[model samples]
Target: MKELKAFLKSKDVSKSEIFKALKISYDEGLILQYLCQLFFGSIPNISILNLLQGLFKDKEEFSYLDHLKDIRHLMELGLVKTGYSMLQDQNKESLFSLLHMDISLSEYFLQFLENKKPLDLSINVAYENHLEYLKDEFERIKLYTRLSFNPQNLDFKKDIQAYEAHIKKRLAKSKFYNVLAEIFKENKLSKKEQIIFIALLKEEYSLKNEESSSRELNSLLALVSENELEKLKNRALLDENSKLIEKNLIDYDEFSNHFYLSESILQRIVNFKRLDKDKQLRLENALKDQEIFELIEPNTDINDVIMPAKTKELLENILKQQDKKVLERLSLWGIKNSKEVEAKIIFYGPAGTGKTMSALSMAKSMKKVVLSFDCSKILSKWVGESEQNVRKIFDTYKEIAQNCKQSPILLLNEADQFLSTRVESGASADKMHNQMQNIFLEQIEKFSGVIIATTNFLESLDSAFSRRFEYKIEFKKPNFKERFLIWQKALPKNAEFSEDFKLDDLAQYELSGAQIFMVVKNTALKVAVSKDGIFSMQDFRESIEKELSSSFDKSKIVGF
Candidate 1:
């Protein structure tokens, strides 16, 4: 009630002017009735409109009947109600229909009603009822309305006093715009740039304001040169750094190149700035690795890896198909020998089944750098924020892929958290699960570059997600012959072979190649630590027994 009163008194026009305008026509009776229910201590009905028209006759410029025609339709439908009972029966379709109407009209009515003064309990109750009826509509309307009304062009003389008062009352809770102001101050943005930045920030973050919020955004249309603004707008659509770039505030490319990052790495740097400090540090460390930094260069070939013959053949076939698809897409798009060709793949399997080794081997065989997607670092804790982070990652990948002339491979590890099956439960967890799954699906379908997603539990993923992937390679546990080779390859050159600890015997344990490697390493460590220079068959056997006991204990799963 206080907020509404403060809003109305701050306006230049008085209650009589609003009433005169609302009561212009016989048809406008319903609008006047609603307004009376909002401003005076009366229920909304046909009689209030008559009283309003009689009270505002001095305002000659106002007309009520003309606007009443619109309100009459609602009356005819019996949609108007005096209390919260109206909202109890509302359906989604009905709410959506009202929202699709002229949102500006809704805003006008809301603003008009908000300007009135005095403590009118009956009117306040009706206003609350109207708000309930239009809650969903208002949410959608506010999104676009706030976007349309840029706060940068506020008139100090006409708006400052009112805006300051409104700000203190309504927008005192938001700190996002304040944070943006700090960023602007720290960065020393130009006045024009600062205004544009604020508008963009409010649109992106959805801030609330008073006089400042009502400022015309059209002024920003002339602030920057057309070409520069378009570039900035497009970049902003991709990541936050685009805003800085649009203002010519910072050169991201130069900064990235100076740090010797690949195009993907550079884009990551821009995206990383939006993340929390711990995540930024993780990405920084990943970028510093020499193997990852060299990914910008083009890959030569990928057939040299000494993997199982079947695995190699399957990968080669998929790679060939991917190459053809890239050429076809390029031709259709009328691009000649384009360097930005993306091929995505998924590798799903049990732990120690060679997913990581295969990815690294593919990169090594092709003489290309493999860029892994750090899932743990990118998934945000804030609601609706994780999807944005994921989008930023993909956008950066695309930018880098396009710039480097080498299609970068994005390896998404432990992707089940994002690609989980959608459920119909009304729990908060379910909503987040659905949102993440939808975002991931959308990104995967639209992404043109190479992406490799790995997961241990493929069944946990949505069926729709599994279908989008071009290939799904299941790295099953190796057979005896494969295990024998793994053991032979993993063993040190100086190690002695004995009958009881033979490779063929060890292969029968059904252990993965990685497990075998660990077993051998641990056996050697035990021999060295015990001051026994000679590593014996008995020592290896004991180590294997100990490993089996410990592994069983770790693998035990209690029922939830």
Candidate 2:
């Protein structure tokens, strides 16, 4: 207060002007104090009634004239200057003219207050629901700004009236109004694009918990032109080549005509921006109707497995090789000109042959979390929705990778579901399946994260998908020697084997390692339940017979 007064007095202003300036400084101090409260605390909103009550508290004895003078000064010197700065601060006044003050001013205040300069206290939005707080502030702004809407000048008056009416009629009722307000301030959406975007929101609001909320281009034909739709498509690419309309708020699949908000922006909208990775994921999962991917908690140390010597050597080489140096050396040696820093590994083979186990081992050795998923879970019955789910799964992993210190491995089990050969059939369902493959093709080309995909039917997979896997190691059924080792590891030492039961004979069944372990466990369980807990060769034989017979029976049922 003294500094402002001294500076004003140094200018040698008139007596009345000095009085006004001094009064203005006093009023500005009060306003600054209120703003400081907003900026320095987790409380995102302050209501008009509460603010006014605090301002005029214990002042009933004061005349109305004095109260009016304070109000006038606060408006003239505080909010007026704040609003002007928000609108003109970027030197893009024309862009601001396209914006409504209700959103622009509030967003500016939020972004400005995020700065740590000269604030009196530390503010944390951790415990409270930030979205709700933003909504309350938005409501306050709407109410306050409406009081000054002018009806005199036709040009300015018509624009303000129409803007207010549009917001009220379209966005006011939305629970996402505050988030949309911030998004609008950040992005440059044309009127039509904004309308279509809002319509997408409205569509999402109408869906049931399990229903797909993806939108198609045809659905927006009535709202926007083809040119605008195409622009939206190009901007959604996961490359630097694409031009973003709103700092990448939404992701669009050009092939399937599907589009949705990006997960990061969605988290920001919900005020989950500052949360730790695990908490953010948990909150996101709780909000979702379905889980996008399965998260695996693997052992901290890599597990040893008995596999083919060639396969073992290949995998060991990959584990031992430094991925960063390999990429750097390739660029330095002029072998390739690329910026990709990821290792795309693939392990495809029969079940129980160590594909999944190898993937877990590789991730553990790298000290990275394994984000595994069964592709069947992501496939939806609705048209175009399955492709959208693929994008979501990839995008979700990308977000997780960004927050993690070590890049995580995205292990896709049963990759055949989306990686299979595309049929050239004329049916739309077939085409949709092909579209899912196409989406992955594009996404995988630009993928910048480590991925490990496994499949049972490697021969059935599309050549294009197979070609993208940098480390394509085929997992085979363990032979007699490997099976012998696996059996030795799986069997309990306390279990007694019959004198006639030979461990060498057990490896000759051509069963996978998983089947061998299951046979031994089942034999022990049956013997323990019926007899003296497995001292006979008959127990092991019966269990093996049943297991082998089930596969034969299934084959018989299928007329194989």
Model 2 residue 560 CA deviation (Å) reads: 26
TM-scores of the candidates in the order shown: 0.42, 0.46
RMSD, every candidate, angstroms: 25.0, 21.6
- State in Å the error of residue 25, model 2: 79
Cα-lDDT of candidate 2: 0.56
Expressed as tens digits, the lDDT of each residue in 72-135 for candidate 2 is: 3333222322222311223334332322221111321232223222311133222144344443
Q: Pick the candidate with the highest TM-score.
A: 2
Query: How well does candidate 1 score on lDDT at residue 128?
Result: 29
